[model samples]
Target: MNAENEDFVRRRQLQVQRELEDATRDEVVVEPETGRLPVCIESALPSKCIVSFDAHESEVNALCWSPSGRLLASGGGDRKVKLWTVLRGQHQCMGQYLGSNRAINSVTFDDEENLVLAADNDMASRVWGVSDFRLKRS
Candidate 1:
């Protein structure tokens, strides 16, 4: 590769590394009270969280199931948002978003489920493209 091309590649790599580092700088938290997730929740005991639920290690503040019910999104006190997809036999975590610098309080999917939106304690809101898990706007 030419020197100009190499320099461009190095700058791109550094940009990606910086973004990743920024994403990882979120606060850690411990579990809090249990509540019903805003989806097709099963009946629960007074004090139990569903075992297979995509629970955060800390408090979960918001949840939204896709329009087709094939995907689920959640945001929480852990400063992260996660996406779960339901297959024939199980729910799998397909992606985890750690770009929120503060606790997330609301999460929702667009009508077509092609995008996800979240609101954070920092008084900021963000939009992400579901297909590539990239930030579309903030």
Candidate 2:
């Protein structure tokens, strides 16, 4: 190869090596104190896992997890609230209830775990029997 081509290749190789070294290097800073022995610490660990669930067609306004942590309920701008089940580490939409004409703002499960209370911007609140998802009238 020509000398000019060889020089270009060597420069590119050096640049790549420098980048790799910088990427793998640990960046840390320590402050000195007068009364105590110095201590060394590594940087905080990064998050290892993330789970994202997209069950609502519109903006999600609220969410509640079941007492067992095996299920989730989500209320959204679509004026609906949905219940989801976590099976084998994946979230599955189990049921949906259209409770109001306007956006549902909040949701919570009752003490017995058999009732769900939902409030919406429609100036109404609803209580639903969790077993059959039937509306409970006051």
Candidate 3:
């Protein structure tokens, strides 16, 4: 490789190394009174019950915990939305919605925990009933 190519490769390697080190470091310093809260690391394992759903063939793009913290909603690049229940360090897929023709990007639950909103690359936003998993139109 040329000098410029070697330099570029070295810089890229350094960046990758830094990212990997950061990913493995657990540098949580919680000082509640200081108002400086620590951010949760995505790769860190869940404390109690953890559930992973495989309904999506593509990457999971968004995830949200339910109001009661018992359920989790996951949207992905597979154009599907899935609901999971956490129990004893495992996640159980409770339901799925294949409403969008494109990848689902985001998901959120209403404060009452009765409704869920999902946004997708198809330029569509949908609301669904949590209890019956029925689509709600506005």
Q: Global lDDT of each model?
A: 0.83, 0.78, 0.82
Stronger candidate by lDDT (2 vs 3): 3
The RMSD of every model to the true structure, in order and in angstroms, is 16.2, 15.0, 7.0
Q: Which stretches of candidate 3 lie over 4 Å from their true place?
A: 1-55
Give per-residue CA lDDT, model 1, range 1-138, as digits (tens).
699998998999999877766655644443346543433223322355333564687988998989999898989999989998867657788888778999999999999888999999999999998889998999
Each prediction's total of clashing residue pairs, residues at least 3 apart in sequence or on different chains, is 0, 0, 1
Between which residue pairs do clashes occur in model 2? none
Rank the candidate models, highest TM-score first.
Answer: 3, 2, 1
Sequence-dependent TM-score of model 3: 0.63
Please report how far candidate 2 places residue 46 from its true position, in Å: 10
- The better candidate by TM-score, 2 or 3, is 3
Q: What is the TM-score of each candidate against the true structure?
A: 0.60, 0.61, 0.63
Question: What's the lDDT of the predicted structure labeled candidate 1?
Answer: 0.83
Q: How much lDDT does candidate 2 score?
A: 0.78
Tens digits of per-residue lDDT for model 2, 7-118: 9989999998777677547665554664454354543434555468777789999899877776688899988889888776677887887657888899888766787788
Weakest lDDT window of 10 consecutive positions for candidate 2 = 37-46
Candidate 3 clash total?
Answer: 1
Q: By how many angstroms RMSD does model 3 differ from the true structure?
A: 7.0
